[model samples]
Target: MAKEYEFTQIIKDHEGVIFKITTIYTNNHEDQKDLYQEIVYQLWKSFDNFRGDSKISTWMYRVGLNTAITRLKKEKRKGNQIGIDQVIMKQTDQYDTEFEERLKILYAHIHGLNELEKGLMLLLLEGKKYEEIASITGLSPSNVGTRISRIKQKLKTQIVKK
Candidate 1:
């Protein structure tokens, strides 16, 4: 269908945003890919709900993040580990450098965070301000700021020890 083609094109145009969310939420290659597919599926399913109330990317992020979070929960309930550590290791093996090592550690720390925190960090990494993150996450602006500060401090401490 022409509509489907246009919709897929729109999603492809914003694929990186979805990939970022998927990467943050899932560590294992399998889970990351599964979650990526799930996000795309959800976007397609919810396309009709788009009412131009917010930016298209904003809506996509909300839906994709929510779907990824929910899928993580479901997988956990099924006793799956998501294998993010393995994925990181494989990635690190491709480049044996201090930066990749540090990045792997940071990724591990991020993987340990809750779903909401992961979403917030992804948005922050994308250069969103606290207010924008709060809008998408339903947290108070101050709370988002506080959480980012704390996360940064935690990462700083970890990086110092390495």
Candidate 2:
């Protein structure tokens, strides 16, 4: 059907966004896959309701983030699950050892952040403007700017302490 084809194409085009979000929210490979599937399912479920009021990517980000955050909360209520401590680096051939180490450290710090901060940092790192980030996050542009400034300072202090 045309609807199915359109949905599949949209998912293919934005799969990286889903992957990044799942990676950021989950520690282990299995959990990441589960989250990824869940996000895709949620997106598909709401596909009919999309009105084109925003960029498709923005809508995807909002839906993906909300689903991830909600899942984390549900997971917490269900009790602690063991997470893999090792960082799994992708595309090692594209980066030097130094860059890989830096990335590991950065991800560790990112994982330490609370959920909201983690979501904000992911969007910021994606090169989204403050207004777009706000639209995705349901925050005002000024608040997004303020939170990003604070998160940067927090990350800098954390790195300096290491």
Going through the candidates in the order shown, the clash numbers are 3, 0
* Pairs with steric clashes in candidate 1: 27-84, 28-83, 28-84
Per TM-score, the best of the predicted structures is: 2
Q: Which portions of model 1 show Cα errors greater than 4 Å?
A: 72-99, 160-162
For residue 143, model 1's alpha carbon misses the true position, in angstroms, by 2.1
Model 1, span 1-162: residue lDDT tens? 987998979886997887778768775776776787778889999888887788887888889888987773445434454443532335555876988887777788888676667888888988987788888888999999999998888778766876
- Candidate 2 lDDT at 83 equals 40
Indicate the residue-level lDDT of 7 in model 1. 91
Cα lDDT tens digits, model 2, 32-136, are 766777798899999989979899999999999999988743343333434422323354767999988988787899998999999999999999999999999
